[model samples]
Every structure is written in structure tokens, then in C-alpha cells.
Target chain A: MSNQSLVDAEWALSHLDDAKVVFIEVDEDTEAYAGNHIKNAIALNWKTDLQDPIRRDFVNKEQFEALLSAKGVSNDDTVVLYGGNNNWFAAYAFWYFKLYGHSDVRLLDGGRKKWELDGRELVSDVPSRAATKYVAKDQDLSIRSFREDVLKAIGTQNLVDVRSPDEYAGRLLAPAHLPQEAARIGGHIPTAANIPWSKAANEDGSFKSIDELKALYEGAGVDLNKDTIAYCRIGERSAHSWFVLHELLGVKNVSNYDGSWTEYGSLVGVPVAVGDEPGTA
Target chain B: MSGCGAVVGGVSLDNVDITNQAVIQGVISSGNAPASVGYARLLDRNDEFVAEVPISKQGEFRFFTVAGDWTIVALIPGANSRTPVQATIGKILDVDIAVIK
Candidate 1:
């Protein structure tokens, strides 16, 4: 079934009771999240919840299960996540849940920004006393990516870079933004495509509709039917990109680079890209 | 006053300069720090609120210093809560509220 866009905060909040929706906040800085967030929303820091210190790969599954359980999430719950102002962090959580085999997951379109913009109410009282029991299927590897999968993904699934062209071009970069060694090891994967993250949105954080999204991907040389991997600085922005691919555009086989440029670029002996130049058609 | 913008972690901070101490302010939702409504704190250059604001039932918080770069930080009980608070800064910026409606 096509997922309804969570762009309208009130409309999404209205459905909170029908699903086990969780409002999340992911940010470059926590300054915004602390000011106030959507009511009953539990906050998950990207550094803490989504990633382990190792970078790129999924953290231990049991650790993830504990974090999920603490947030009142359960296997049966339909997880609706949001981060910062828009669906970025929500997409991160969406990717994580799916990687862990949580069947139903979605993003709150426009995320907190839209929710607050719509003038919906927010309270910090996360008073849900009921701790739902969450049982991992142990081998439910239905939604995650591994190092080998990404290594083998070259020339298989189209790798889509959601980062800005400057980033893709290898200009205007921070020392810590990406792995220093990535440039020498490799450039864009052989057949990877470049579709900057902003392309998915309409200036505002709200995303373009499915039809528009479909066209955007097609125009960028991506085939919705085949495999695709979305990536950005860390896994967060790419997670948002993947959300659009899977949820809005209805792409079947899509995954995000959990290690992303940081980990992948740092590998001692991987191929690297140089300059803002496109590799090859 | 020049707003204290974020020093690190933003890939592209909308270029709005949100980390200034004058442009933002916040409250800690869960803590024994003894904060109350209308209570406000002055943010250091690092963009952290040294004091706490007592949250109003309506969650409306107004620091004495407005119309400058500032961010409001809510002191939630948990340690990790401080980092995720959404912050913004501009010539005409806003402080987010957790008002109880």
C-alpha cells in the first residue's frame, strides 16, 4: 500500500492512536530539540541510538532492541518517526526499523517543523507507563545492509549520492565531513547516480509528491524497479533519501549506506573519486 | 548582538547563523534543577544556557534578551536530551516552547 505523506502535522498526529508512532528529533545540534518537541515524542540521538562507534554498519542487534524497547516500540507497532524540522531523522529511524525487520515504518512528512508549523500542540510529557514487550526474530535481517553487500553492490544496484554536488564534486568539504582516504580508494561506484538531497524537496522541507518523486529519480538515471543505494555525509541524510525512495516513490529494493562516506572513504584500500568531476557515463 | 551560531556538526546550517547566544533559549523538561515559568538564563558564547527557565503551563518562554542571536535549551532529565533540541537563529528568530495545552 502507498504510504500517506506525513506532511500535515495535525493529520499525522490525528492518527497517532491508530499506530505506534514515535516522534524523533535528529539534528546537527540539540539546541532545537530542547526548545520543545512534538508531544509524547521520544528523542533518539543519531550518535547514540542509530550508530555504534564503529560507523557505517548496524550496531549489535540486541543493543538496538533495547533502545527500541525503551522508546515504547514493539514488533506490532507501526512506527512513525520524525526528526529535526522535517522527515530527515524520521527517515533514519525508518531505515533502521526496516533494517531490523520491523515491518511497518514511515516518516512524518515535514517532520516537527511541519507539525509545529501546522500549529499542533506539543508537550514533553512522555508518560506512557506501558512498556510493550518487543521480541526480535533473531534472524530478521530483512532490512539491513552489510559491508559485503555494499562492496558487492558496485555495478549491481545504482548508487545514488544524495549529497550536494560540491560534496559529490569533492569541493567545499570539511576535514571531518568525509573520510580523507576515500578520494584515493574510489570515486562514485561504477554505475552510481547523483541526485542531491534537496532535489527531493520543494525548497521547504516538505517533499515532492510521488509522481514528482518518480520523475525526479527517472530523470537522474535511476530505475525504480532495480536496486538502489542512497547515501549522504553520515547515514542520516541518506536515510531520509531512502525513505523517499521506498515510501514515496514506491521503489522495491533500496538501501542506505550506513557507513556512508565517512566509513567507506576511510577504508585503507578502496577506490576514490577526485574533484567535482563525474566519473563516467 | 551577533548571534552565536553552531561551531560544528552542520553540513549546511541554512547559513542562517543559529548558534549565537542571543538568538536561542530553551528549558529542561525533566530535572531537579528548580526551574520555573518566566525563568530565563543567559547563554554563554558556547551557546549553552547557564541558567534554567521555569516552564509555564502554556510552555511560553521569554528570555529577557530578545531580538538578538540566542537559543533556549531545555534541561531534560536524560543526558542525551540536550543535543537533539532543534535550534535556529536569525535577525528575527524564535525560541521553541513546550507549552502544555
Candidate 2:
């Protein structure tokens, strides 16, 4: 039940004054941090800070380095990320941190939802820190997957589509709240397991125990022993699952396909399986 | 990056175009004033988690759903509430949730 990749509210509260720990909030709603946040925590807009303005990919390593440097994060600082919507974008940022080879990154368990539900203190005051010269390593391709990788892993690896059942079943192209026209078609990648990412989380927005997570994935026929790639509409949700498998469960070979269904379901002549079942490869 | 960007919800109904869409939208309030902070979660008919969006400073939340029975759960600090809603296409359903501390 111990995970080095996560810290609870108690741990976060105790570390509020820790010079070596940096609390970063990455919310799906970028404005959440402005209204109120955990004291001394800074905000990283998942939309602007993490994404490339022109391309569909993330910001380059230099951008990432400059971002951390501006945020006063040193190479040795332990970065703890948390956000709203069960830390969906926080996990995305965590995966991005890992992709850039940052060694001491962790997620704040339950994120803003759990913190607010617990009646924890949140403040609107922002903190300022001296800028540091931050360095980022090259992208770690091992923890990331491309469209070709997903196509090749159809029958060989465990492809877990972490969208809701309706999305997986081709009934909805995107989440209910989002515009439904992101992809040209609905349905899931062929042979992908339809294990919704929400299953790994609790009602209070905290992640489930390791045993429960393992059981949930295994019950969905996801083979943990095999190389795994998790995807959602745009990869944020799958990053939550990626955090669970690779960080919490200690799975060695897991990747988050950032392009996800937005790329896969829209590609010309790519295999897409419709209906409730996981279609054949 | 069509669906890749963040969807900032909690917008006033005036900003949303509900044309040809089945919408479940609302505002969160406590003591007759807009709740400043909270999240509105959408649950399917079976009570399974569907999606979640942060409430705006104005305490607004909107969901573009298909015609069906759904439950909206408001998670506000020190207070929480849920309301069942039935949505039909080409119509907008407004359900205000009142939470108390």
C-alpha cells in the first residue's frame, strides 16, 4: 500500500514549508488555481504550459526547462502535482515530468477534490520564489507511445482504452461535456480492453488501493506482465492509469499514448472496433 | 488538437448554445449565493462516473448529454448534493443544486 509516487494531504500539509518540495497544481479547468489553492502551491495550466501552442504535441524540452526554471524548480526538488477532476491533468503533468526524466516527481493523492471535501484550507495568495537554472533531460521514449506503436501492439501488448464504456462502445465520440466531434468516428482501438480509468479511483477522488487496482485491471483481462499502453480521448485520463500501473503497481513496461483516440479513431483506414465488446485484432 | 484542450465549464447559460443538443446545466448555490468553489460530476443511469467539470466562480456547470436519465453530483467544500435529471434532445434542462454547510 506504500507508494513513493504519491503523498497524502497530511504529508503535503507537513511539507508546506519544505524547501525541497514544490507543490504544483495542474487543473483541467486552468482557472481553478487562481480562485484558491493549497497554500504556497503554484499553478501550471495544462492547456498553455504543458501543450505546444502550434503543434498537437507537448512543449519541447527547452520549453519545459524554462518552465521549471521560471517556477524556481531545481533539478533536485521533489515536485508534487495535484489538480481537479481527480487529478486527471495532474497525472498528465506527472507523466510529462517523467517523460523528461525528472526523478523526484509525485502526485498529491485525491487532488483538489479530496482536499476540499476534507475541508482543508485553501488560499488565493500566490508565492514567489527565486528563479533557478533548470535542466531537462531528453524525452524518455520508453514511457511514451506513438500511433505506430499502438497499431503494432494490437494483439501483442495490453492496450487499455481508459475512456468511459459509452465512449469505448462507440456511443459517444468524446466525454459528455466535451464536443463530440473530436474524432471522425467512435469506437475503440481493436483488441483494446475497455477498463474505464474511473474504476481505479475512489468516490472521494482518491486512487484505490493496489490490490483493488490490480484486481480491476486483471478482471478486465489486462495482462500486467505484458507491455501496456493506455489511452483515452486525449491521453490525460490514461495518464492516471499509467500512473497507477507504472508508478503505483511497479509495472516496468507501461506507456501513455498521448495522441490517444483523437489520433487513432480519426486516422484513415485504421482499425476501429465498435460495440460493447473489444473487437478482434 | 480538437478535443485535447481543457474544457472550462461553470459558464453562464448565455454563453452556451444548446441547439440540437440535450443539455443538463445548473448553478451551485449555498444560502442563496453562488458557491465560489466546487465540482459538478455526471453519473450515468447506473451511477457510474461519466465525467466531471469544475464549477466557475459564478457556480455554473453544464453537461451536453444524450437524451437519458442522469444524476448530477455537486461536490462543494463542507457541503454536497445530488439531483436526478432527465434530458431530452433539442431541449435544455436547468437544475440548480443547493448545498449547505
Model 2 TM-score relative to the real fold: 0.93
Measured on C-alpha atoms, candidate 1 has an lDDT of 0.53
lDDT per residue as tens, model 1, A102-213 = 8766677766644543446666555462566676545344344555666677766678877655456554232212112213332454445667666676423578877888
lDDT of 2 by residue, B2-91 (tens): 443335563334544567457788898988899877788899887878888777778888877678889999888777888999988779
Q: How many clashes in each structure?
A: 53, 1
Model 2, span A1-281: residue lDDT tens: 46899999889999998989999999756567887899999999887888899889999999999999999999999999998878898999999999999989999999988998787999999999789999999999999999999999998899999998888888777787764453278899999998888999987789999899889987887778899999998999999999999998899799999999888988998888999888888
What fraction of the true Cα-Cα contacts (under 8 Å, chains A to B) does candidate 2 also have?
Answer: 0.44
For all predictions, the C-alpha RMSD in Å is 11.2, 2.1
